[model samples]
Target: MSRSALKLRSWPLTILYYLLPFAALRPLARVGWRPTSRVAIYKSVPTRLLSRAWGRLNQVELPTWLRKPVYSLYIWTFGVNMKEAAVEDLHQYRNLSEFFRRKLKPQARPVCDSHCVISPADGKILHFGRVKNCEVEQVKGVTYSLESFLGPQTWTENLPISKTSFQDQLVTKEGNELYHCVIYLAPGDYHCFHSPTDWKVFHRRHFPGSLMSVNPGVARWIKELFCYNERVVLTGGWQHGFFSLTAVGATNVGSIRIYFDRDLQTNSPRYSKGSHNDMSYVTNNNQDGIVMRKGEQLGEFNLGSTIVLIFEAPKDFTFNLKAGQKIHFGEAVGSL
Candidate 1:
């Protein structure tokens, strides 16, 4: 189909696909309805099937004539800047996934050379600050548990208390103080995410949960939104302290592709139902250690999704960020 024809066909479908959630979720959120209620039909099984279908569709190659119009509408709809891409011509990509995971020109995003904490991805900073009482802010008033959010990771057991605020839930065990931030990727933004600092990835954990939307609207309404979603938790640390970078799945996000571990998969049907929370796990321990420099590609969301980073920095560290700030993969967010 031609570009105009494709747009005409796609626009309505696209708008409705997104609008149904907005229409249905907003009111439910306002009324404080649980996300996993009847809404699971929209956010659970069917959405997972849709996501899997979309993933399969993206891999189907179309002829060049059809590709331009289809891909053009996608770029225009998302407002993607082809110039910054490593490959400027959209035709170079074999399929949608190829284009979605396209690399940028090396110089397009310059790495911050100084010793500071950098952004792990190009997206809006939904929340950024300390992990207080073993919880991180989902929105201004909404928060989620570190233990529940990360699932049954061993590190949850050793978190030292630097302070006490929650009655029994040790916020910080003893010497370890945790800080965190949430970065949300919209459809138009760069899809791949990188490491915020030069760090080692010693282990990882994948927790299977709901595939609900992580958009700001859904986040405010859904309790434990991040924890309730399927997520891949990457455990690593710098010289200062331990940290975790969580790749959270959302509606239509079929996969979370990790650069190092190709075996890792997200939004899989195997995890859709049953005792997945207890049965599902992917743990990789690198005794030799897999070290990645600042701005190194860690993984990518097959579609737009969210990344949550949790860590304990040095006593001298201070976050130069706030809620709702826009950030890029190589920009500085804090200094140690």
Candidate 2:
């Protein structure tokens, strides 16, 4: 399909997307909806087909005039704030994908403290706490194994003997010392993600999974939602120990790009070998590992998405966080 035809189809979706925030019945409407697993089974085929087509178009060259409006539609759909971005003019962007992942001004977001773990983006806190053993809370009274969250090999390779008996230690470690934080990026927020702490980008892994919506309602219903969604997991050792940040993909959001590693984009295939039909692989290790200072840009979602931060055992930090708190880039997430 031509770009014009795609824009026409996207118009109604854009209108309904804007109206959703103002609808008086928003809360009640979602009460009956399960955004996570509520996949439009029939629509999956066409959606995937369209996504593939768009993926191809994303690489196509176009004149400034045609690219500007297409890029604007993307920015509008995701509620991207141009003012916060380094580029003030929408037309300055050469293409839709460029605008979708625009960078912010250097001073727009400053790191909270040189010694603290700053929030990676302007987003709402979904949840933050310790990962006792191998289990982390998904929602109220619901917990998913960390082994499952990181995948079997990552669990085995990272944890060793503690793997089998990990989740059993949950109750003993429920304290303020260990921490995990979930950040949900709304369409209007900045999409670029930053490093929460100083670390070396030693390895990056992508897991293939579903493209369900990651709205709060969906997160509450989808067991292991973060683990199951298509995500790029960046792992590196910090002052304390190992730390990881996952950039999760959502419905209609096509790609997650990492700024530090070129291997993820150049060498790996876009799809994975699995039942989920998601993408997975580690970025290349050829280049010297990129070391990021706290609050440095790590990567970005092509559109609105979710980020989950995980700290390894023996966590020694404390975050002054509460459920449902709104966080911004460079805000204090926790102190070591």
Candidate 3:
């Protein structure tokens, strides 16, 4: 009887609403033009469910004879170098998940100790530089709120935060600056993420959102794409001041496994959107939190994802990386 109710009942409009994005993309596809961020039809598909299903599919063991052919196809498709894997034989991996979580030879990636911070994973650097106006650049020009990304500074009760500005609250010491680095893992890259520096992880925050693709192109098209996806934010302290590492989920990659936190689950069947879960690592052994040395294994993803590092450093800090440059897990990202 109501106008709003009548509109909701209109099947013609409902069909047009859902079909418009696809219809527009038909011509683009025919012309060989591909859009990276499917923003228009993003809500049309159930990406989270697909990712979880993919996670399960990864665990399904294949026939012994089918392993090599199946894995070889993936390796060729993604350009994965089998020589780097500790177990070079494809048969050693029982399932796709095993192959994904395969270990690399110890000597494969040598950590660069000369620098202050090393890359957490082997991927292309999306962006890195100083945080301005409490905002971090998702890509070249796209930005997201720093306060929103890492949540509140409630984990820093010891530090003076009451009277300081929002950005100033994160600076544990004077003359300190905030820096961030975004690393995007491809399907071919190693799945494990490591500690970029010697730090103590005090708290962990999990933000569950859509499981969208986080490749460079999508990041360029979608502002705050990282903020919109499910991400595990590990906040801690280093020699400089505040530090954090965020593991962002992506399409077909919903399972984010933190080696230390077994209780933390991601990409669940049912969850409330726009809500976050938090856990503190403070204990007798970790007065501040879990102590992690540089290059220590932190966690892993089922498939390629993204790692974001935000830390406090001196104004003299400089990045040794170029935007869009490929880097390995132990390579230096920045230094004094």
Q: Please tell me which predicted candidate would have the highest lDDT against the true structure.
A: 3
Q: Which pairs clash in the backbone of model 3?
A: none
- Model 1 agreement with the true structure over 28-76: per-residue lDDT tens digits: 6677776566455455446667677778887888788777787787777
Better of 1 and 2 by TM-score: 1
Q: Candidate 3: what lDDT?
A: 0.84
Can you tell me which runs of candidate 3 are displaced by over 4 Å? 1-38
lDDT per residue as tens, model 2, 112-142:
7744688988898878887665667655555
Root-mean-square deviation per candidate: 5.2, 7.2, 9.9
Give the runs in model 2 whose Cα sits over 4 Å from its true position: 1-50, 54-80, 139-142, 153-164, 167-178, 265-289, 313-316
In order of appearance, the predictions have TM-scores of 0.83, 0.73, 0.88
On TM-score, the candidate that comes out on top is 3
Find the number of clashing residue pairs for candidate 2: 2
lDDT of 3 by residue, 182-300 (tens): 99998889999999999999999998888877867667777788888899999889998889999999887889999999989999988888889889899777686889999999999
Rank by lDDT, highest first.
3, 1, 2
